[model samples]
Target: MVDSPDAFGRLWADDYPGDFLRDLAELGDRMSGRPGERRAAELVADAFRDAGAREVAVEPFEMNAWKRGSTEFGVTNPVERSFEALALPYSPSGDVHGDIVDVGHGTPEEIEAADVAGNVVVASTETPPGMDRLYHRMEKFGHAVAAGASAFVFANHKQGQLPPTGALRFDREAAVPAVGVSAETGTWLREYADRDGEVSLSVSADTVPGEGHNATGVFGPETDEEVVVLAHHDGHDIAEAALDNGCGVATVVAIARILGDIDLDTRVRVVTVGGEEVGLLGASALADTIESERMRSVVNVDGAGRYRTLRAFTHGTPAFEGVLDSVSDAASREVSVDDALHPFSDHWPFLKREVPAVQLHSVTPERGRGWGHTHADTWDKTDARNVREHGMLAALLVRELTRKSVPRPDADALAADLESRGLRPGMEAAEIWPAHWE
Candidate 1:
């Protein structure tokens, strides 16, 4: 708790933020498609209207909903053993009560060796090697799924409590419904198979193209202007996105409340993209069409509730460095300026289109860490005050950028910076020079 001049909370408390916290707490409840989120979005729209914005609408997008499918697993042998497990978030359904075949780790080699056709494949957890192996393993898994394995069940790893879980990312032509299971369950299944010779179970689920949406609404009017602020609204569909992004939307809405009441020289756009959990689809869509010419910069807020280590970075040009500093100058003392990878959020698409953007974030390790696409990220982990601070920082930053014109770097300098950052051409860093790096 450093007594710094740039504490964002003081600003968050400004403008008499009455009932804003209550509104944020309610946001969690309203977002569940359950009364929580449904109502939360409504409240946001209402607030937008009250803010005197010209327009406010909830534009819906399509996304598939993964529901529970028929699930049954047990060991059929001298000793009857029933193992516990559940289908992955987007797993396929297989009611095959056939014998369970040990496919080793469900690896391609293991699958090829075993006769798993029409049979359930009890797979062991196979992490190729290093932390970087996840990518190759995932890609490999996609190929394995496409190879026509009847069903995929990930055996528990030596470590990791819950079934080693993951979602499949196949090319446009390939799709596989895979689920992970607990390591204990895997061991039991294996032991049962060794003792019983054959173990049969039922694993069926409602698997198909899911349909949901990336709901979005823009604030402020047209002036060939853009100050895109982002927060992902979608979660695993189990918990309220309170801190995961419920707070993010709340922060964005808070900014709307602050900046909306006053007239600004530049437009302040707020987008709570969907399918962020699944992928950066919503953000990508915006990035695809955003008039880079109009886009000044993007400010993304994620995991705002706990700046236990709030950090910011600039992956953009020199002007963006100024943008980052401008934002940081008003951020909390708890916030640090650290180097990070890509925004990896809805901002990627904008970057692809050459829009200046960066994701404001904080990272926390958990008992079962890396809950990004897991069921572990719940509402209980959210902190309201932290979320408020996140919103406050964004509002102040946007206000600064909208009016203050920073020094734009020349093309060569911008190019050199992008190159040093290992940027690829046509991606976001390709073209720069004499440009605002917009």
Candidate 2:
């Protein structure tokens, strides 16, 4: 038992004594469905068993494995120059030459108005303030694909030589060559788009069908209803992928260790899924096997614990706000809540089913995946103190969610909420909008 809120605080302080840090450092570069990801899953399973969780199981699922290869992006017209570029994961090998069409900020409206057919489309990774939701890399690429573009280029918003990298496709191969460039390179590309200069894109990669595992463990009571705490173990191959998910995986492990022995009214399942970066494949796989009605709620920790404070995406489940408020108030912890239905994380599979859920992440003043999906996503950007403290808040929330009951939302209501949130345009452009909504 946690005993009291003060005791929980002390536990959080004492828990991050440095052992978990060493563990995370050892699990370096956990790319989805690869050896690094497998090692991470094994480590999490061992930790769960060591924490006294019963029936700890590592279930395997099939995933399309994507191997990174060399990429070449150059402008042949208006002063020939080659810019440094990184190939997005799951991008197919191709050689393409077309006119560069710059879609400023890559909004749905911009994509719809541009004549990208048989041309190369260039979009920024930054999301404009006028949009209600964040524009994802794949969404931007999807817009290009929808416009019949021969290739896609994503430029970083950050002012550095660092090129952004993310999965171009999930569970399937990309239809066109997709690459990322730095902000400086993006400016150069814009010069070409302004004059309608010809750009050449060449990509080389390999793909094979592979498998990834989900580390699942059952804690607390034996009940029909289950509250699942999930975090993805997979990350991009560019860097250590620490802040993007390493902090999340470690925090979930610590939460399971602390709350496993406590008595509760419902069962709590700790899940560390794989193939998240390549599209929430592992989470969707697990959700398919489980009965949706049996799922009480989900607390998905993806980009959380990177900062001292934590925030949550409630996905329009107002019933979930009570749990967040109670836990934050009880622990005196800083946990911000956003009642938006963000369809970008591991919680999306469950949320699409109308199961109540929240995707946990660290709040930042800057927008558009700051330091999230790049080579800069290393371990040093995070601290053990944030991990432990965030875990404490998650533990408290899990306990409360297990004790209390929240209402389940219907699919039609969720679809309507998406329209109200101004998310339907992006979803339709990205081709991920639910078919039933039509």
Candidate 3:
């Protein structure tokens, strides 16, 4: 059994995680390929150095970067009213006028049933009830593209005036222009659509070649096998990104401090990646440098520090679940484990390469991104207690993983699991399905 340390007492004394989160927020718009993102990488590298990590480095990679610009969405026929909208990343500059089609929840079934061809399709950010998993925004966008929709509108389901923003595709221009609207505006749009109203959408944006950075360092004993602990430092430019990922990188930093004092059998590599908001660019870049056999396991702290209780996606790896169970039992802190395959997040790039990986998220009552991609994702929405608690659990999990000899997942079996979960269809639609799986 792994012994649990007084993580709360140690963290509470200094509140390093809280301070790190605040520092990241102050960087201002750590968007991928931006100056803020570069500064954030430097800050994380400095934190890693201070945490006693060795060979700390900031790696750079080229990426297809996108910039937000003026977006206009309004009812044109039978009414004249404009709604506040934000152009999703990778949305090309265009002007489209078509009849609005509401595809509730934006499920495959809904898009297939609706006559969305040559029309603007609006889908809610929330998934349909009773669905096994939440449909991602990219999946909805892909479905609309496949159906030949002239444009796509993502409507936030939460009852706030905040419009959500996310990438339309990974590292490429979307087939159609896309934008997000507030829940209130969504209601108005739905009502107007019932009246067979036509709407107009104009988006102005730029897609250019840009660079992404990954701040990386190593701790523990030098070994051929390493356990990766990673979180994305890049966030949407819309908010302070406190909840979406600022908490994640901070938790990673806090865990690094704990790992520095522990004697481990394997090396622990801590990485704070950029371009996760646009795509998993930084993660993919880092993954390419490391061979799958050398990676013992990956513990990604993406949405981990958002709540008190932690939720771990083990990616159908039995060894990962076992480790989490042991950590929970030893630490006496419940970590809700789901042995499911989650294809999003920084872990995906590694998991797709047949590396055993676990993504540490949180247990939240809300279904969709509660305040994740909106302007409301600020530092005020997070609690330092959650960061400290989650960091402790993550550190414990990492420690256990380093000592264990977990087998790598079979590539065929992993692909089959994704297919069984009905994720392949969406992945294929999103153009993220690995060619090897075919």
Candidate 4:
């Protein structure tokens, strides 16, 4: 480990930046359920081998894979105009022609009040006030399905005619056809709301069983308890999935390269998960096999290198605060931590099992998932400087986590923490709240 400031600076400038960028290039356009995702997993495993890490293996698992075909969305009444749209994964392939019902923000109360039966429900991709959390796209889609809506439309909060795409949860297919449109098109659709105009949506897709794999690179001494460093190698089929996860996996590889030579007391497992865009299948599969007691902590890098600043969601693990602070101090860079409960990424599976986990993400000023899960999520949006700096911070964090003596929270305490953070309701509504919480 380059402990001295001068050595660290030299190593950062001369070595890891190119390595990080190369990893990003190797895992190009790694969309889940596609050949690119499989290749990306192999690339991750290869990176571990190239880094001289031991016990490098690729573990395969089964998942319900959905492939995108084509989508058509437009308003046939009040004002006839075709809109650009993308089909949400696992959305059934069919056609639905019905009246448009605009439920602003798609809140549960708004959905309950709207007349959604046998009509095309148009809802925002963003969460509403009093929800106090970012509701998944699937959550709004679920409300439409429950209200007997014939079709569903997720309108992106951002403008620029960028339609967002995200999948429904694992193994659960949408009963109604779902499509995503831009904020401008959504606003235009809202104008016809007072008139309850007619609209039509046509989506084409297929669901099939496929194999997904997770690449695990085990290093350091063999110990009963281990610290797992994680990032998903899979992304949506729409774009490159650069900001959401390519940055994350790149950081993981860079860290493995830097820390490969360090001899530590505890085991450090670097795992790059797949099938995360459609669902947390890879992480869930891994979580099921490993005894939760044997896992010390998980540092999941999901939305890393998107912005210049680094932020971490500690998931209310107070003990993580000191480690994050110490690492930031050592690097002379800021690593902000939000001690709230965020249950959307690969970390959720392990964290829900009461194993302490932290998700590393770059802080963005936007309210929702901006430029992510959209065609705008391209490699050009990522910066090498951000990746290198966040990589240094994350490596420092992993080192600290491996050496620090931290207590894992029990299931009861984790459930209580979720409740205290005002996240249980959203999780329950999304059908992701842990069974112990019930």
Candidate 5:
């Protein structure tokens, strides 16, 4: 059993996580490559210094950044009408007109059978029920590009007139224009498509060379081996980004504060990264420079504080499950464990190098991001109680990882596992498949 630190008790008595989250929300639109993102890096750096961290630095890296402009979507035929929409990141500026084609879930098979050539394709944000894995928005957009669609429309499956926004591709402009619409607008478009309606789409955006930053600081003992605790500080421009990642970085800060007062045997590195909304650019940049062999493990706090119960994706690491169990038993709280390999988050860069990693998210019945990318993702939607409770549990988990001897997965076996789970096809379609895999 892990011993609870006095600092952990102090966390329960204070709302540090929630306060940090609110502070981040006040920065306004911490989008990748934007001024807000730079301010966020500075804020995290200051917070790290205040938490008694050493060697606090804000590292900058070059990247291809996207800026949103104006977007318009309208049905030009069969009862002309206009709708509200937001341009997805990396969508090229274009004006196109074509027949509307609704590819239900935008799965590869659905796109193949729908014959979306020369038409504007509409795909849902939710995947089909009972699918083995979650189909990402980039995967659907990639399939549409391959099928020669003139434009792409991402329709949120959830109701409430909320339009979801995410990137069409990573680090570069997409082949075609893309935009997101509310469920109400999607339903109208689908019904209009049934009557052979046509639509016009115009998306204006800019893609240029830009820079992003990573705020990193180290604590614990003077050991060569270290455990990395990280969360992205970036979010989409459409919302306050409170739920998607404001809570994430806030949890990291709280953990750092608690760790500062605790005795430890291993070094702990805390990082809050930018450019996660466009891609894992900040994480990738840091991973390229770090010594992967000296790393013990990675604890990524991405979506942990969104709900009461926590979920840990172990990336097929059995040792991580044992650590989570220890935290659960010691804290007397529930932490659901899934030993699947998820290749989409900030942990992927380290996991690709054979490092054992776990991503801490919240347990939700909803399939896709419920209000994460929508305008509804505000600070008021979250609870301080959840942040305090989950922050304590994650802090314990990080401490346990530092003491445990976790073995990294073999590179060949890890690659084979990803292939066996039907992830390679989607990775390739999204142009994110590593060149070495080929």
Candidate 6:
């Protein structure tokens, strides 16, 4: 009945096209589960079952999952302006009404150019503009907080869905309150930038502080040499995560379909992490639970479908490098894998635990990875063929890495691999905290 082995391989390579699309479409119906672990647990468990996984169970952990209420903002400057805004999750709230400050989001020189201290600074919801847009507007927030500013007003959401429900994080935690304004409102604030007197902004919101939970699925018990696939399922609570990671989730689903039934020679775990938006919380949690000796490799897929590149970063070891190379070779299309390395992903945690890890993302400034965390990340951006290829690559890596049959890189070997890639140390040391954080 089956055509041929080559036919199946072609299908696996995503030449069939429709397979992963169908899989992603079905996940939309399932995303309605409560913003609780049970919802993610049940949904992911269902994915495991549908994909033919066995011994599936939900590993639960305590977390603080917060929901929002009425969050609002208004302005009184050279021109009276009013609009809506929401506080980022885990943000410290306050009834902030102060002189609007324009703190350009950059280095100490930029902060020096503006009177940012004790004023409500308004900058793009993001910072550095081009360094890494995936962090949303966090760099600016962190800078303002460090500058002793009272509050911040974001300008990015002026035209889109980012006004609220956009996932937020503070690198060193936040002390002041911040909110976004409508584009028209922001223009009004911009008008007051060099005026004779200061203007007041009245912003308030209903945000609570809480931790987030991650859901993990296992096909077998843990072992000394483990293979893991990582994806973040937590979303902005606005649109279904069709591409932002519905693709990664679908890849896991597809791999589960294939790996669920195989009697494992090595441990295989498919982890759908939570709150990758806030920080690498889920990955960090997994890192804490891992035994360095048991980990072989981590294949992390985030921002799966948006970009066309097969962009990757590796904690290179002979075996791990071989695995990445093999997958890269097998791909149907020559997706651009990059030389640029970042230690700022879910993969970072695994590497910290002495597990060789790599990330699958696309559209960086250098290699041109797609916009991952922005409002533009949506279903329209997803490509069924790409999603299927991701599944194939992940499955192949898991299979090849797990064979008792396969040789793994030692811990020292893994560390050296990461070091050579220029990712282990990641960003260079900074002299002082950013100035825009309030």
Q: For model 2, which pairs clash? A: none
State each model's CA lDDT, in order. 0.54, 0.83, 0.89, 0.80, 0.89, 0.56
Which tens-of-lDDT digit does each residue in 42-108 have in candidate 2? 8888878877788898888998888887888899997798999999887899999999999988877
lDDT of 6: 0.56
Ranking by lDDT: 3, 5, 2, 4, 6, 1
RMSD list, candidates in order: 7.7, 1.9, 1.7, 2.2, 1.6, 5.9
Q: Estimate each model's TM-score.
A: 0.67, 0.95, 0.97, 0.93, 0.97, 0.76
lDDT of 3 by residue, 75-190 (tens): 99779989899999999999999999999989888999998999998999998888778789999999889999999999999987999999989999988999999999999888
At residue 8, candidate 2 shows an lDDT of 58
What's the TM for model 4?
0.93
User: Measured by TM-score, how close is model 3 to the native structure?
Assistant: 0.97
Error of 4 at 292 (Å): 1.3
lDDT of 4 by residue, 131-214 (tens): 655767766776667778998888898988998888865655768788888999889888877787888888898888888889
Can you tell me which runs of candidate 4 are displaced by over 4 Å? 1-7, 14-29, 129-132, 420-422
Per-residue CA lDDT of model 5 for 318-417, tens digit only, reads: 7888889999999899999987686788998999888888999999867789998999999998887788888889888888888887889887887788
Clashes of each: 28, 0, 0, 0, 0, 22
lDDT score, residue 437, model 5? Answer: 64
Scored by lDDT, the top model is 3
Per-residue error for 377 in candidate 5, Å, reads 0.6
